[model samples]
Target: MIEWLATFLTSSPKPDLLRLVAVPVFAWAAYRDVRTRRVPNRTWLPLALLGIALLAWDIYRASTGAMIGGLAERERFYLRVALSLGMVGSLGYLFYWFGGFGGADAKALIVLAVLFPTFPAYMFPNTALPLTRTTVGVFSLTILSNTVLVGAVYPLFVTLRNALSGHRAPIMFIGKPIRAADAVREYGSLLQTPEGFSRGGLDLDALRMYLRWRGVTLAAVREDPERYRDPTSLPDDPAPPGDGSIPDGGDVVGPETTDATASGGDEAARAADSTVADPADHATDAEAAGADADGYDDPWGAEAFLDDIEGSAYGTTAEGLREGLNVLAAEDVVWISPGMPFIVPMFVALVVSLVYGDLFFELVTLLV
Candidate 1:
């Protein structure tokens, strides 16, 4: 064991150290993304800077003839770095612009390009690192490919789970039926509405964001459903003692306010209503007054509350929220797609790339 450890440590100490440092950081980012569907932009800054510094150091070593390779090897190293950064960076941005990658995911790939422009070679007792390598040897590109391959397994798992549960509908593979009461507390998007299932679902994360922006808890809204349903209620701001007037800047519902929140709400409501017929009447007034809706009440003031908050943030639009609210208001059980955070797969790919190299490349090589 000691001999093996010594060999591993000696075989690319700098690259090994960087890989070790990255494991914990990527783990943290993945955990946060799973829990909150967000990772702060600042999360990547330190890693990005460190990657830049390391790349610069490598270049300096090559230029000073301290690196093992002579002039030809030095020029090759420079070319590799240029190709990796140029190709990987451009691809990352294009993915983001085309909506295939999240901002953080794209940044992760770019930073990876800076960090590991070429495969970091290592020798172990049983096998060699990077079992296969392409001519360009863009490590970031390899990571991206590996990530996609690793992520493909999740859909199969979802499909199998749904099938075992007797939900054979094609849509069931992507999402599951969850109680409407649990919707606010969950992650993912609503896949069902009052009318039926549709692919263009409402994002629950946006609903959570709107709730936070209003400074009101979903629990509180559930407790006093009618209070929130009223257009005049300003829960985020309290009135002065013995005064009924709403405080300034409070989200008061009125014609003047229609320009911002209400207008968005109207548009959202129309969009939501477009696909579904008028909601069915199945609940008593008493049950309708509650948050659970029981398929009778319109989502207790969901549109009005959405209209009271700031214009959309966190990928939420008023129409989406309105559609989601309509479903939540009108359905007891709604199907939701619990999105898999791409960072989780990216982290797994990073580990696999470090130890086994690109699995996709290896498979292709084996076939050929």
Candidate 2:
């Protein structure tokens, strides 16, 4: 046992050590993604830098013939690393560009490529360390394949949960219904709207984030819905604080706005009149607001807040907020699809990759 432990600790090429270090980091990232649906860009920086440093050290050792197989092995190591980075790095960027991967997910994969361009080896008495590996042996690719395999089970779980709850629609396989009032506090997008069942409606989770970013709470918004809806009523506040900069006061209402509009002032009366407009005018207004003919308002200043942010970090747009708000305001119940946070499965894949190796490869080998 001591001998094995010493060998494990002193393993050459050292990627296994990095992998062990990454476990906790990946776990933290998954937690953040699950809770807030956002991971800070800085989260990947340390891992990326450490990966580069280790790669440099390995290359240096290989060049000096200190690597296990001398100069002959150096060329093979170079090829493997190049191929891994070229293939896996390109895939990660492409995934993000095509919207298949989030920015953080893509970054994680790219960093993994740099960290473990080739599989890191471990030894066990009864079993080989990696039960399966691909022909190319790109470790990041293995991780990605494992992630997909793990993520694939989520839909089945959703379906089973819905089935047990007596909701048997095809759409129920992807989402479930929750009270509209609770939508703000929940994690998902509205799957069913006033019109009908739709896959894309309002994202309640994003709404919650937007409100939190603005230093407010769902209860506060519910208390004075009309005040938040009126754009002109709000004070000229600066951009919403960045992530983790939530204002000192928790669950506090945002800056006070004029109550004139809520109290049936002239602007309020005009808004009321606009609601009764002819179909053509109503359609024009709805189009402008990016909502349907049914009344939609930015009750939490979501549109302005989204615009102020550099990018769609929360995976929502101003128009999307308006459309979602419209549904939340009008509906008693809304069907929502709580998106599966990919990071969670990615973390699981990391662990499985370290322990049991490539699950996809094993399955394919079994079938073949």
Candidate 3:
């Protein structure tokens, strides 16, 4: 069985063999991403190692002039492959650093850079694409361009769907509205603001600013010093939520209280628990107590954001969305992100690039 499997993978025309190998790998990645919204390193690391070995072998062949025909062409091909690998690796790392590329995506691009550096001659025997020629052997860029182009079509499809459905919100082009209750049940992310809550989405910039205002940085929080406590541990606030940011305090009526006296008693009870549950909430309550004593409106007295739920990448909790749902009790719907997996488009792009040699490049050439 091992011998037969090796024969099947290696016996075909080089292009066909490459496709056979790639399809299974790409399909698996796409499937895993769709199911888990994450790609484990175990899925791509072996492929990357395989790509490195193949590229090294290709280089050896080129250096020794062991080509069956057109030695010069082979050398150029290997050189282009090497250069493309370097360029893609550098850019992928940079993009990952800046959050433009997800972890799986950056690693996948690097693997592709090593594995499919050139347009497979067998797949497009008589191709005359100028972009192909310019890229030398680097087909991954073309694949990326083609992938983006193909992915763009889905947004248009969603827009048309929304238009036909009579959903007129402009933000519907990027995302659609659903019930906040359903969003919580389905683990969907907020796409828009609800009443009494700050904007629904996690604003990384705002979070950074909030941390800075509290005299803490992400580097410090991530390092997790014994004395650091939390990112929002300023002298004023003293302690914040687990994510190091303050929940938007508004008129939140807790179920345990009916009148101001009951709410105050509940707050006292909460102060006792907050030291253990969340010091930040306790601090906010202390501040609210002072404000109430001074006859000022207390934002922290509401306790609407108090329910704890699992945390998300945006640092908000399910409890936060639940609070938003409470505030939006008058509204029927909310906008949310369904967590689109990008690997699906990447898989499509891989197949498209293999068969068509870059859709974007072909369009550009036709226009020229």
Candidate 4:
């Protein structure tokens, strides 16, 4: 069966093995990288090195076996090989620059490129050729086939694994991110989460951002407590009150007139707010106390912070942060975007494919 299959493929009997090896090898590496955010040197280095070695061997043989039959002859065949690899290389380069792929992925691409120049396209009945006068057909099909296969599987895998682990990222959006309680009883449909509320989890970016903001917030409130606090004053601790600074309730309050014990700014106003003689005069103190009940302005600017900065590459604005969060929340995607709208290797392929597909093609895309 293997011999028969070999005969059924390229008359050259080579790009087939190269393609066969390249596909699953690269596919597994690529998928693993997406899942673990790592592209091991072992897989990537071997693919790139072996590919180059094969291409080199093909080149040496082609030069001596110059009698191989073809219309354009040896020079053109070699040139065609270069073109095929070139197309793949160029796409990989762009993705790397745009952060869609890593250094290892870029190298893997280079390995794939050499096959065409080193071997021959007729190696697989693969009608792909590039930059040369040869039709732009094969590039398109490969890209389309690849996109459908890779794009669907990787993200689906990421989502399922993350969700199943009950990993809900920390949420600090609320006045105080409620530890997403296990039983959110609207009427009493005890739907509980396996994992209890977390500040947020599994997202390095948000955690980084949270830490930065928390430090800034603490410093700001510490430095400008009066400006941040609503009452403009805090209840004076009789003797070096607990912590020197009164607990400024969450919200901002106006200057208080009474609560002699209200906010500080007095010589004889050290009496308890309730003990004050003129309760009516204590209106400012009452208002300040009320405001404390509400949450205060985020001195740290946490309200506007967002972890997904890449999505902004196309255009993510401040106001759009809400839209971004809403999308994350709806999809239950935690901190990651549902559409990792990367610089898909297929962008170039799209144009190249359109050229050939219009000239000649038919495809059946099966989402499953």
Candidate 5:
């Protein structure tokens, strides 16, 4: 079996097993990218390890004289593999670092380099394209270039589709409009205003958080202990008499005066001046005492600060539709980008290189 394997590896001149492994892996990546716009590490890591193991074994065989290929051929093969791996890895890192490609894309490219450092020898006779036959050393690079060429046509297709659908300019050329409701459900990003000039809408999420922090419910704003308190100005120690305010000096928001604190001296003086109070006035006095006890004078309470920055609908949250009401109407429009996943183009390029050779080579030939 070992002899047979050695003969196969030396005689074939290409990693046929690696090619077989790559087909399904690349296909899975294409599907994952299109559906989720992500390629998990699990998809590429195993394939990369397998390629590395195969290469290591080849090296071991060659060192021990178990490899059947001529010394020159083995050396050339190792050189090609090493060079291809380095070139592909460096390019992938550069692309990822520069934000030209996603991390998944970079990882997939490296895996491709490991798996197919050289083109499959079995394909040579059948490959009709001249570039495929000639450029066996840098198969991954050809795939990368081809992917770029083929991927360019997607935007054109999107533009044409939008034009035919009677969609307007700008976003129309980039991506077609789905119903705002549907768009919110989708993973795509909204291409519209982040927020409005007025208090457009409340983010229920922020409201909920504020409610939780304040320990208040929507049912009873008036009775909550934390209602009149400023969270940023809560004090640990009580204010001394005649001070009539917390140490922090944050006033309790109230209905009456903008400048808070009625003053303990004024309250004492008023109490002394009052001889008799009506039964109805007793309620007012008690309310005033309650306000004094809390050391807060704000009438509006924390509700005045409720105009918080709500979560945006355009980003990861998908909280609300941008211009959703108008978009719900038949005439209005909204724009969104259906995220472009890079793996689909990569898959196409792989197939093209296998069947018709490098796209750039063909283009050059046609031009010449």
Candidate 6:
């Protein structure tokens, strides 16, 4: 039985043998990464050692001009593999710098560098074409498998991870447009769009996407810090009292509150308060004041809400302030990214770079 098993194994192709050895390793690394959001150095350290060992062996063969393991020139092979690994490392850094992947992720890439060759090593120098039709067929099948898995598996994994995170983040939501109060979708966190906000560094698109025009003044507090400081409109925060640059006893009402309170007494006083207002928040405040002036009801207190939310709103209005801010918080409608998808600590691209060289990229890019 042992002789037969050895015979069967030796009879199998080298590419198949290599794959048989590699599949479990890649799978195990992926499993650890998914399970703990980390991959242990123990697993990768061996791989790094393997790379250094392979590199050394190749150096010996190249210097002697002898082929080992039936491969091509050792120097060419070593340089190619090292250069490919370097590319993978560079890609990982590019992603990490942009806020992708955790530290463990880059380490994993380094380890992977030792194992994968640029392009599939199965094809031989004997072949004249850079890629044979047979190779293309095999590559296509592999790519198809990977793409399908990513689409199906990753989302499920994210769902499972989020479920275990214990944060009770929202999963889905119905976006209802409200007029005046600060109605934000809780699940989206700070993931706002940059459409109109590129110029201001404010959250106008965030208001539109998450808050969605739902707003109401929670309070009518006359002495809001916002009034004296005008965070959004004023370029700088109020000078400390020691500087005396800040006016004494500045009215708390902003252009928003002033506009809402305009009918009460003086427009000049309202504008004179001269503070910046975020359109979404400002609209909510002015709407609250307008509603209060007209004897309407409120849910999220206007003064309290404004004091807490950061930044200014742009071009916000108050058509139906009372009804907008009434809906209570729910459990779904988006995902929370500490950073963002664009800024992840670990990404799948590194793995691809490890397995396939520039060819893999050119292939994926063409297909994608």
Q: Highest lDDT, which number?
A: 2
lDDT of each: 0.66, 0.68, 0.53, 0.38, 0.53, 0.36
Tell me the alpha-carbon RMSD of every candidate: 10.6, 6.8, 10.7, 15.9, 16.5, 15.4
Model 1, 233: alpha-carbon shift in Å? 5.0
> Which of 3 and 6 is the better model by TM-score?
3
Predicted candidate 3 versus true structure: per-residue lDDT over 104-187, tens digit per residue = 888887777777776654422223222243344577777677778877887787778778988767576766666532332232
lDDT (10s digit) by residue, model 4, range 248-274? 242111122233312333322322222
TM-score of each: 0.74, 0.75, 0.62, 0.41, 0.55, 0.37
> What lDDT does model 4 reach?
0.38
Candidate 1 regions exceeding 4 Å error are: 13-16, 68-73, 125-127, 193-195, 212-311
Q: Report the lDDT tens digits of candidate 2 across residue range 168-241.
A: 77588888877766665556677765567887676664665555455444443444455456553333454254
5 or 6, which is superior by TM-score?
5
TM-score winner: 2
Clash counts for all predictions: 0, 1, 1, 14, 7, 34
- TM-score winner between candidates 4 and 6: 4
Error of 2 at 146 (Å): 0.2
lDDT winner, 1 or 6: 1
Q: In candidate 5, how many Å is residue 137 off? A: 2.9
Ranking by TM-score: 2, 1, 3, 5, 4, 6
lDDT of 2 at 49: 92
Q: What root-mean-square deviation over C-alphas does model 5 reach?
A: 16.5
lDDT (Cα, tens digit) per residue for candidate 5, span 1-368: 67655654555545454566777788998987765555788988898888887767667777877766788867877777787788987888889888667779989888888876755553223232223444445677778888899889888898988888787676665566765323323334445544421223222223233323332222222222232232322222211111111112322222221221123132332232232122233234535434566543432233222323232211212233213222222223446665577788888888877766677866787899
Off by over 4 Å in 4: 2-15, 85-87, 99-108, 116-141, 144-336, 340-368
